[model samples]
Target: MAGTPTIFLHAELLPNIRQLTLHVSLPNSASEIDIRESTITLSESCRAVTVFTLHQDVELVETLKLPVKVTDASRRNLSFAGHRVDIGGTESKAQTAEYSFRLQVDPNDAGLTFTNKGFQEDDYVPWTASDMSTCAALHCKFCKQMIVDVASKPDTSSWQWKDLPSGNWAEMMDFWHCHKPDVHPDDKEGQKDIEAQNASVKGYGASNRVVATPRTGLVDVASFLVAESDCQNIKVLEQRPTSTSAKPASHDGKNARNIGCSGCSAIIGTEDSVAEGLRLYKNNIVVKHTGATEHVYETHSIDIITSSRFLDLIDHEGVRRFVIHAGQSNGILLWAFNPDLRYSSSSADHSIVSRRAMKVLYQNATDVERILEPENGVPTPLSLEELFLPENIYDELVLSLRRSNLLMPISARIFREWNVALLDRIEKRP
Candidate 1:
């Protein structure tokens, strides 16, 4: 629709209400095309839709077929209605026509049944909860260099893998210990002394401190925190102060450094000085399980890993807004519209039976330094979680967001400065 001479179809089935929302984008304006004669064929086995348009210069026909097979109970219950076709866009050069309709199931169909295989709770495994046996070996995805061999640890008898409670574990501890309700308001000096004494005795209120034990690997939503003595073939870059980070300091106090793969010099994670260990990103390393055969290793893409992190953030913090900063001038303002949804697109792969995804509204914040400042333009200070990512990972996230637009209808791809897209949820294997 956006100057391309191709058709795009997007379909979203709302199984809860037994309805399907459909959108079809055309290459020409509404005046130049006609769809009164178009046809849709629906059966228990498949769905086929055909569009025929006649213009003064040319005549075109296109068809979209969905490979979904339904039960016989739904064969006689589904229908399409409430059709709307019109032109969309602000400028003439970008204007295009789109057709939209809803396929509904009859309210009287009591015997109707739907397949819900991929939408189960267990399928949405968080990255922090991902399976990792004590015997597994961590390898760099880029160079295949072994970073940590769990079976070879000096204390194999005590070796274990444990997941952190949440991504904001340290922040929560700091808030609880520093802002205790029982502290007296009159004695400020006494409060400070009591807090310091409690911290020293219990060692439970240290901020930004993630210490990894000699025989345990601490797992968080994004990275694995492990002792430095157990790592190999990795390099830690010189620490430098971050210019655009709005979040808390890294493990290295006020400075942060990239942890790189020794073979390819590619960034795999960051150095955590507080933990005296390496925070290896999950997406950059492959995991060879204890009983893996044929040398197969489980690897996750950067986008999938990021999406899981978003879900984990939403779960723990109960917030959906995030500001991802790459540098001084560029960043992304992201809102998780719907944390989980079942979606299907005609332009996507037909082989897949079900797709679990998250709908997101993202905007490219050019003036990132002032985007959230109340004095600049924003009305008030926003409670946004901040992520300071390296340049390469930031680019990959932006690319993944933009590339997802191709799998959606043109009319629903954008809204003002915010671009609408979907980040797929990682499906766990049995």
Candidate 2:
């Protein structure tokens, strides 16, 4: 019989890896390989681990200690096959143990409801069960790293994916609530602001409170939906606190002196630091919740904005130098990260999009647009269409052709590439 092979996080660095743990397994094969991190490349045929030779490998009788390694520079989050890992530093206050999130399975498709809400965080709304569409919002972290898949499904080493557990389906609910600003008769101040923004929108008059995407930022889907109707909330990635530990250390002692912000990694109690972490916040929308605490952003408020405030925060008061966007089937993925985050959140309707797809689009778009551009990294959007899918994703003509499976990889890959190319072109246009 094949050896009971497994992997472990031997070392995080090529030279040194720390924090080792073993969690649950995947659903399909019971391959006890724990899928930590949300970031990874999606290959329909990629397997979760190279050691997962069979589905039964996941159902190991003893706690399997496979030597799993994190291959990307992005943060490594915690997640399993169909389930997300449940871990947090905000709540735990652990120093270096938060390596990833951990959890079991409970896929009732039971939509997330607001309980412990924060700014721009929301759950199921009894009010718009029919009018608005909802998603599971699963992912503890937002790193869009990936592992290999499908063609060599048994050995998933090549596929890349988002590995950070910044936001899972459930946490995503919180994220959605924070950014997707809610507006109703209840939120008077918020309503007033949205009303004013709504008025300034030219041509697209009906668009609601979506403040014009900052000169550098693109309008998020949640914001766009609000522009269309009473958007439940909008999720944006702005800067926030990372920890309440050691006061930020100073590299120059002048500006970095005693710098402590919300998401600081080593923030000392009352002491300040220059580092920070991400948090969810809201723009418009009247959020009213029944339960929770009283942080600037309530844990259980009716208003929610699925946003990443950490993006607004920079390293020890660092400034956001990049404001890029990626188009997705359902919406646009805004990439806004500061130096502190070390890892970044790849925005998407689903958890991630394939790197190969991004690469293919990068290669092809150069010909169609007659422009010479960098192809190594994902294309960043500078315009609205560039940020989100322009044509109805399902209706794109290019995708329709690949649906028959002629293009290598798969249809999913083709569509993802097209989205990347389309956004690149639209963003580059004046």
* TM-scores of all predicted structures: 0.75, 0.17
After superposition, the stretches of candidate 2 with alpha carbons farther than 4 Å from their true spots are: 1-261, 265-289, 292-430
The weakest ten consecutive residues by lDDT in model 1 span: 111-120
When summed lDDT is taken over every stretch of 10 residues in candidate 2, the lowest stretch is: 421-430
* Alpha-carbon deviation at 203 in model 1, angstroms: 8.7
**Top-TM-score structure, candidate number:** 1
Give candidates' CA RMSD values in order.
Answer: 6.3, 24.0
| Local accuracy of candidate 1 as per-residue lDDT tens digits, 142-175 | 8888888887845457567887765566677878
Where is model 1 more than 4 Å wrong at Cα? 1-7, 14-18, 26-37, 45-84, 87-97, 105-130, 153-155, 170-210, 238-249, 291-295, 348-350, 376-378
